[model samples]
Target chain A: MKLLFSNEVKEHRFSLKCIPHDTDMQKIENIDVSVFPDNITGKDIDSHGNITIFGYTKELHDSFGFDVEGTASTGLKDFESAKELHMVGMYKYQTKITAPGESVLDFSKKHSLESCSSNEEKALLIMQNLNNEFEYRQGCTDMDTKAEEALKGGCGVCQDFAHIMLSLCRLESIPCRYVTGMMIGEGRSHAWVEAWDDNRWIGFDPTNGKVVNDEYIKISNGRDFRDCLVNQGIFTGNVTQSQTISVIVNEEQNLIHD
Target chain B: MISYMDICGKRDRVEDMEIYTGADVVNEQLARYGVKFGIYKNNEFKEQLFPFDMIPRVIDNKEFAYLEKGLKQRVKALNLFIADIYGEKKIIKDKIVPEEFIYAGSGYLPQCEGIVPSKGVYSHISGIDLVQSKDGTWYILEDNLRIPSGASYPMIVRGIERRSAPSLFTGKHIEDNRNYADMLRHTMDYVNCGGHTVILTPGRYNAAYFEHSYLAEKTGAHLVSGHELIVENDHLYFIDYSGRKERVGAVYRRISDEYLDPMSFNEESVIGIPHIFDIYRKGNVALINAPGNGVADDKGIYYFVPKMIKYYLGEEPILNNAPTYLPYYDEDMKYVLDNFDNLVLKDVAEAGGYGVVFGNKMSKEEKEKFIAMLKAEPRRFIAQEVIDFIDIDIMEKGQLLPRKADLRAFVLMAEEPMVWKSGLTRFSRNPDSFIVNSSQGGGFKDTWVLSQ
Candidate 1:
């Protein structure tokens, strides 16, 4: 059976409502987006039989960052599967200039654009740099991450990789977008990336330089990974967070009859 | 001849008494011990409740002796075939079994090539399923050489059944079936590294979790998961609750070959103890059923078991095999394609009762699709004639009903290949259902081979 793929990119404008409104007006400076689109190829279709499109933004909007509230819509398509679907992606909004004298642009510049290269190369360099620069320590970053802070700590997972790469892409003026997609590599998990080069955004595995192939199936996209959040809703009480992602790709043969 | 009345009177003397004319009661008692097996569905654990019947199918001593000889001969031949496939490829040269069938089988593991196992025994535990017809004859149904389960259930059930019907035991001099634990222990001891025996389980949530723990407890072996095992310096070691390290003797691992070694078979396996295959390869530890034994268990390879028995044992097969058709053969492929609706199609690579399509159960379009699939990848599929064995009564909805069932009798090959006197008798719950696999909503009964 041919697994249905119904994701097409169309123009969209989205808005967001930040919780617990920040009263300090001086902390707000700039707002920017780093998302883009890419064309699908025959090779992008997986051998185990599934269509995967993983495109994301790699830009950081720092200076003049406002206590952002509103929606941003883009020309993108929604994902659906007739049988079952395994989707993983993230949409994030990085709050810039949390304190006085810390300009949003400086914070963004300090985190973004340290290296300018192809997505694959950049991902490789980032992994080598992370391995050389930081100690392999866990519990360093949470959902609320600052690229500047993570750069100082020198250790993070794919989320941190996406955040740091987004900041850099934004500094470079690349129309990078944050993408949430299912990674059918050795294991299944959500990964983030910045798309640039005429919306033909390629994925950068900052943890490793493993290029996103047909195995990486896109779920959703936005400015950052937090924007394309899979399960994000405020609960009534103190919630200890726990998450699990399982993706099964089976080899399906479709005998096309004339 | 002792009639049903005599059996009922004997069963009445026991508590929680239920007199079954056949083997189904044994399966019921096994279910009480929580001895069930499991299979994977979409990467989730699903337990299999093998349906069993109460009526005990009596095989006279003379017939059983012949069957015992044939089963041992068949298992020995299979072990030799595995050795040859991994070592010499002599059978292929002799033109007995085709070479492509061995290589094309998904169960054929290239990693096991040239690596000899301890004691040269590839299939230590074999669960060979057999069925008997109403005319009083038995035929081999299937062979499960890789980590076969259900022995513990019968071993435990016999204890309960004997206690429940003590008089039944007094009249029959049935061979004691409790020696399976001792047999398994000795098999492990033959390949031990001077440490304690461990039953390696995937986890508590696995479908065979109950059996893994049950077997471990019954055999005086520690139940350890993949996380509890560590390999250092090409030697296997187990981590204890007291934070101590002890060398592991034998691991009757219930996990598949791919998930047993992350570094070897599948790099993404989190449930596997990384670097453990290296220890097995180095002969520092023994893997029960042994990795790569799947080469023999492949359903496609099953067509040659009788031939294999003849080749290695230099003897004719005592037990008869159901007529099986391998699509890989040109004539067989043509036959299967022509008779798509008459034969049952099975994917040789799939087990736990998945990817089986009965021709009678499908629509015309579905049959066409299967035909196309067979033509496209003939090696991946096999066709078999549906066996219409005798059905026995099972309790359901407060009444007895006849259900299709089969028996998986465990044969332990430590000192010598010995069949467990008790077997797992599984039956289908649905009256119309022909597939009695426990994973497909079946229940089990304890099998009693009556000693006349």
Candidate 2:
């Protein structure tokens, strides 16, 4: 990630959630993080268990950036059962962006979402119907886009697909959440859905219409896309600023089967 | 019971006293002190002087003592509730407060989970609002655990009042309210980790800017803005004009939680000190009225406070909650719909007298639309039986008119809970309106807790 300011800026505070932590399904190793305009860093673990590395740059700087590299051993194991049981109701309710509107509600009713016996089945039904309806496209929806809007627009990115899936599943009282992390073959980070079933969270990728597998590395999960932001910052400068972000994930040839 | 007749007799005596004639001087002094609250209308910010009424709200010694006990008990329970919500899931697991109310509520900040504040106190200063019905029954209206203002208004005005009308107190015995500053200072000191204490303000454009500065002055704590403070080496520091940094251990932040730290909360908050939450999480500094207090004070959660008092304290609530009904319950929804015209509906997500709607006042078509919306989203609203609270006389151009009023009592937590002897008594300027919010052009009066 890189940020360029039109003028010199000081007192820049930034938080990066790009670091992957150890979970039952994935083990992160050999993590190295470097930031420009060197400063003291503080590490904090949010309630969702995401690791946030934050720091302040007091010196004058027109440009700032950070790079994070790590290795992860990924799997499709259901590890969320160890989490507290009280969270099921929290994710069952809808948030601002995931709240079902008239169109989303009608779509849920049309899909007979309540007929599904378990939350996992409802999540799968939501993913199937949303995948059939939505076209994979970028620039049509932004971070602030709601599930209802994205559904009506008939096109969005992974975040939108995840939001729509969450909206539909939550309308049926299915406990679900939004997940953001890296994919083995994808250049950018990906968003997916995880539903609580059999006392464990099962991952589903609505964007690709597939269940999560060993290829995905989960970094953070929350009620919606707003909680999984990789990088956020604020600086004191009147000048215009622009940001550029890119992600690269690779698999070792020995680990990949031909 | 202090009836309306008793208040009228007291009013007759007040009319003969010198304090009644000194109202203009007191108001002028208040204006001179720049005691004003800012409000926004049509996207424009305007600061208006908070008008003061000479007639005070007098509570008998016994009545105030009862109120003090109840307020302290209520605040203690609220503090425990905040701690429990963030610390453990016992409350949710025990099914006392539903998980939906804890997590789904907008006030519930997930970032605050598992972090216990300094001294294990969450609401260091609680502003619990109450109103007295015609029968003299006090009902808990709402709780403002997050940065409750208006106490500074009455605290400052009382000094001017006593100075202007010294003769009024010669015969009558009223508890001196000047001790509020000391009480507030104690509350801050109790939670200080180990260094300088400061009051963090959003700036002069904020609504309660005057209160922020006044409290800082009265308490002798430096009033600093976000930019004046910085976080370094896992500690918060106050940078002076000379470029020297003083370690600040306690911050009575007047800004909301979302705006307290840009690194942890809203990234667009330019008025927030970055990494402050990081230091707070590290237990390096203390944040007064700890972040995520909204989880306890959300209007929806108000319905469960009496329940909380019972659950946490295992005692009967001394004060009553204003006969509320949560639309989320099917039975309450039926009750609300059956007696729709007698109930007052409030949107849980709104505050400052914005989302309140009187059932009888709504037109037929508006009522239908609202009912439909309410049916669609039951958890979004709460309905309450409209209590016909008694009114006090407010002098308008030499004529006395009765107006609806409420009291905001402050409870400061140190080693134990300390209830302020006086409170901010706000009265609706409109005869029919029950909302006494200063943001809606309501006027305030001093509350007199008689020493006798």
Candidate 3:
């Protein structure tokens, strides 16, 4: 299956670096990008399994934009054979992004999620539980909001849903990470999770209550929401600018669906 | 066998004691030179002088020889631990150390995974604290791998003491500690890939700002702030006061990992360069102590260092850690509960003499409350047997009194692990206090390693 994923990122008073990285399930077919203002050379793969794009810059005064489009073929994975094998950097996913008074294990016990079940079954159950737990209200929480807070408030965006699910999965010792990517149909950008099973990584989007398919393309993954940021800005400008992201996912076969 | 030699100071104990009679005069000179610690509590800044003692803690040449060897071996094992945790993780896989102990702590940073420094050196400078018990056994306290400071205090005070007491210096033989600056420069230069070396400071407001600036001047490296450094084209460039830019090859960054890059770690950090971490990841520049070393020195991870020495180097530990027990294990938790009143409980997350509780001193009601909290969060605490460490004499009201002291030995990992011939011996001011931290009313004495 072929999928096209692209996003347009703009910088205002602060400059942004739009990173191009590789993911597990899909391999990139072709990368089309235009970096304006400046570009730096050299790169390496970090311990987190992310390919670092080094020395790309957008200076102050004018807004520089990056239009990145990539085509990839989704491949089949045998997640069953991956278990009982030691994975380097697995400690990265086991970390809990703690918020004040956020006891994920206590919440799990409250929901009786400690039953003897397979890791995937537990992950799917968590996704289903969180769909009912959250009201799917946008603007209810910001990017820095923790899952424990969102669960208590009863409303959050996809980012919060992913965090809540990540906390629950880590409590069960199931390795999980946060992923920012493009989903099929209509949306600006999507936040979801990828759980490490025996032999492969499986994606679960609790906000939509479904497993991600070939139509989804992962941009980057990290232990928490702080790591998967597509565009990061650091500048000394005194101006406050409101920013927006534009994303479009196109499937190769234009199949009409009900 | 003593690998190196030191010169013995000819003066006896009484003559050395006579030289310290003018300690008050030397202390007043310290205030004039602005040798102070700028402390910030409740968001308010206050400056206080880090008082110095004239009496030196003298160590024989043979004793220094043993300490130097152990310091090298311990730092070597620690560096290997950092490398393994980031890359192979064989220790975790073999079940030599529990994964929960390594990953559960706040110091373990996942962002630092896979970033090997220029020379595979994670801790360029390791400040290993050691305490001598009353029976004369040296016990390891804790390792300060990430920017272990206080090296500058002795480096600066020596100049003042040399000028103030010329008569005292002529009669005694002492190892010159002024070569520390040269050692530091060599360590930084050893890993340089070609460009200039710069000391990147968080700014004057940071606690270790004095050391940062002092070291920059002494080593002849450019002293730069975060604002003065920029990441462009995957290279770190230092901008001069005239606004000219030059590529930086090695950077001794004097800031925490969380505050090093706004793009990588803390998004709200205004004092960090945005893409500097990316530059480091590309291997274009070298970070002094490397990021993600906190996991190795964490109070929780300290329990497994002796095990790391065996796993990484296959050697018995030269130095012994103070008898410690972690509550994370069921057996240790049981021992801690059974001997609650006899042990000193320490919160793993706290440092600088904070979060330490004497179980014997707690009231029964307070003890019950603490035990409940300890049971509720077992990983957050560790229990240790209090060692009655020996004391050095200090002049309190012109009368000599014994107070607990601890030595912080500076180990530089450059051309092999080079332990400084001398160390910073800090003594507590309060008679009963065991904590000899400079932050907790502790004054420092120069450690003299005899050449005899």
Q: What is the C-alpha lDDT of each candidate?
A: 0.61, 0.87, 0.77
Model 1, B56-137: lDDT tens digits are 4344456667668878878878888888877767777688887656655667765576678888878889999887765656
At residue B236, give the lDDT of candidate 2: 88
- Whole-structure CA lDDT of model 2: 0.87
Per-candidate TM-scores read 0.60, 0.92, 0.90
User: Among all windows of ten consecutive residues in candidate 1 chain A, which has the lowest summed lDDT?
Assistant: A82-91
Q: Write the per-residue lDDT of candidate 2 for residues B108-165, one digit (tens) a residue.
A: 8878888998989899999999999999899999999998999998998989988998
lDDT tens per residue, model 3, B263-340: 777878777777778778768889998988998988888889899999999999999999999998999999999999
Give the per-residue lDDT digits (tens) of candidate 2, residues A1-258: 788899999877778788888887778899998888766478888777888888888788999888888888877264456355674566788988998888888887787765778877778888999899889999999879999999889899999999999998887777888999888774778999998887788899999998887788888888888778887777777889888877788886334433
What lDDT is reached at residue B50 by model 2?
Answer: 98
By TM-score rank, best first, the candidates go 2, 3, 1
Candidate 1 Cα lDDT to native: 0.61
Model 2, C-alpha of B180: deviation from truth (Å): 0.3
For residue B157, model 3's alpha carbon misses the true position, in angstroms, by 2.8
Q: Which sections of candidate 2 miss by over 4 Å? A: A2-10, A60-63, A76-78, A113-116, A138-144, A236-258, B2-15
Give the 10-residue window scoring lowest on summed lDDT in candidate 2 chain B: B2-11
